[model samples]
Target: MEAFADWLASSELGQYLLCREQAFFDRAVADAFGFRAVQLGLTEYDFLACNRIPWHGYAGPEASADVVCDAAFLPFDSRSLDLLVLPHALDFTSQPHQVLREAERVLMPEGRLVLTGFNPLSLWGSCRLLRGRRDAPWGGNFFAPTRIRDWMTLLQLEPTATAFMAYSPPFSRGDWLSRWQFMDNLGERGWSLLAGVYGIEAVKRQRGMRLIMPAWKPVKAGSGLAVAGGNERHPVKQSVQDEISHG
Candidate 1:
């Protein structure tokens, strides 16, 4: 599978898809301020192109990666990473949930997580299905966007933004792809779920967050006025005096 991934990057169709996906990555993470940013997989795309982080790293089973490590067991320290990008890593891995757990562990509180994957509900997904999962990229699993978001929420990560891209069908020729580029606008406007890929950005929020509300309990009012004491029996004070005198 790793060999397939490396080879896919050299393919014409893969290049086109990479350019589109990388553009989305660039736009999504351009404003994400952080010191350490890591691209977990798909080294071909250079997911950190638009970021100005102090330190950046790449990790995968591929030798080209900065660190070849398991996605379910990253080498970084707990709460050390500021930004993490997983480009088509989850669906390709054996234990996707465990990989997410590792990502959450390494990310600091309020750190950003950018995940990209093939949407199972898209046209590309259907094509991959009809074509069978025997060849290079199509061989991997295609997870749904909503299910992916739910998984992030379970880890106490809040999704800040999501973008769907690569709306046109996977085409090899540059001219053919350009003609179908109008689909990108359409997908962004109305047919969002049909986009081939979805990029989701979530922040790793710490547990035990509390909402700040006014420090007061629900107040109950007496019949009209409060009770006062002694001979303070003015008209307005009579109600108070009555209650106090009765007591």
Candidate 2:
């Protein structure tokens, strides 16, 4: 743990933790779940995992939990949470699947899970492992995004989105400008080739499927609006618009 902390203290991603979406999601999870948000990691004081806790002493009306506990085996009940964030915890966890299964067990039907990890296909992953660097926690089993997608499928979690980040650590203080220039030119999607980490968002895929019947609902015969192929109403519900607006 101490070694990990030392490495992080020197890594550029550590510095960016505050400005990144990781920080935002950490707080968002807490807000979405009230007192149910929890973080699991190899150990406490991991900046990547710990820095996301909110400033307030807890959350909710009478209860609050900006962040709580460091137990690797979480103590939450089944379907007890709305959001689960891995916080790049998979890269270092010895029992990654076990942790993920626990998370699945605790999440509700439509719950969302986000995972962040090092990308083995990326330049950073290759150099970190093959180069045999001793300074940082590089290279154990750097995983590709596809393998993670498979795992999510097996667990009935559908990957809704995938994105890469950290496109290459700013190893030297003097090279900061160059790194930013490169990233700015390439943008995040193209930058994944060099990114230090990548994040994937997955949601539990509902087992049963729904079939929409365009003709099921009755429509006024010969209405001015064209039904096109079916009898379904042409004017989509305004509530959908409102919902999209809210979402």
Candidate 3:
């Protein structure tokens, strides 16, 4: 699994999928604004090339990466990153929920998170199951889109859009792949949830309510009329009572 990046970089099927994903990712994250952006897991693809972020880093497991670390244990301060892109990381990780929680921890409030995964309800997934081969991605665990959506919701990540890509079945030949390209249109409209791969964009949200307090002071009774001596049994009132008694 360590050389999986190199294997994928040179595979014919991988090349085809990369071409399809490049455009989809560019559109999904090109206009995103951020000071720093990260591409995790798939190191060969620069999916954030069109993004406007100043700093972009790529990381992979047991591979040459700008920052070599685990996705579940990101080495960044809390709320430091503006954007994050996980290129099929969750689908290929042992702990998908932990990776998501880490991403949410590093992202600033309202920061955008873009990620992709292999859809288990698609032809490519069926092929993976039939092959029963131990490879980088095929060996990885594929997840359903709805399941991922539920995970995102639990992490307080608000899903903005979910796009289906690579509608064509996994084919090595250009002619056969081109023939099946019509599925892109039909799959996008009707069979969207059954796409081979899916990319979801979500925004991190902080849910704490703001606290407001009003100023308060001790209240004294009869303070306003204390100077007038209206009903305090004062010496002046006592002298008036004595004169009334004498009369």
Candidate No. with top TM-score:
1
For candidate 1, give the lDDT.
0.84
CA lDDT scores, all candidates in order: 0.84, 0.58, 0.82
Total clashes for model 3: 0
Weakest ten-residue segment in model 2 by summed lDDT: 55-64
Q: TM-score per candidate, in order?
A: 0.81, 0.63, 0.80
Per-residue C-alpha lDDT of model 3 across residues 1-247, encoded as one tens digit per residue = 3544555677766766778788888998888897988888777668888898899988767555788898889988999988999888887678899999999999999999999888988998998898885875677678898899899999999999998888888876778888888988899788975588889999998998888888788665532323244555333445566665699
lDDT of 1 by residue, 1-247 (tens): 4755664567776776777788988998898887899999877558898898989999888777999898889999999999999988887888999999999999999999998888889888988988998876787778898988999999988888888888998776778888999998888898987898888999999977688988798755444443345333323356655766699
* lDDT per residue as tens, model 2, 1-247: 2344445556555555324545544443443433344444422332234423332122111112344433246667788766666655566556668767777887778777776777777666766766684645663457788888888888888888777666545454535634564663475546556666667878876688788867777645642433346555555455654665699
Question: Global lDDT for candidate 2?
Answer: 0.58
What's the distance in Å from true for residue 182, model 3? 1.9
Error of 2 at 172 (Å): 4.2
Model 1 pairs whose backbones collide: none
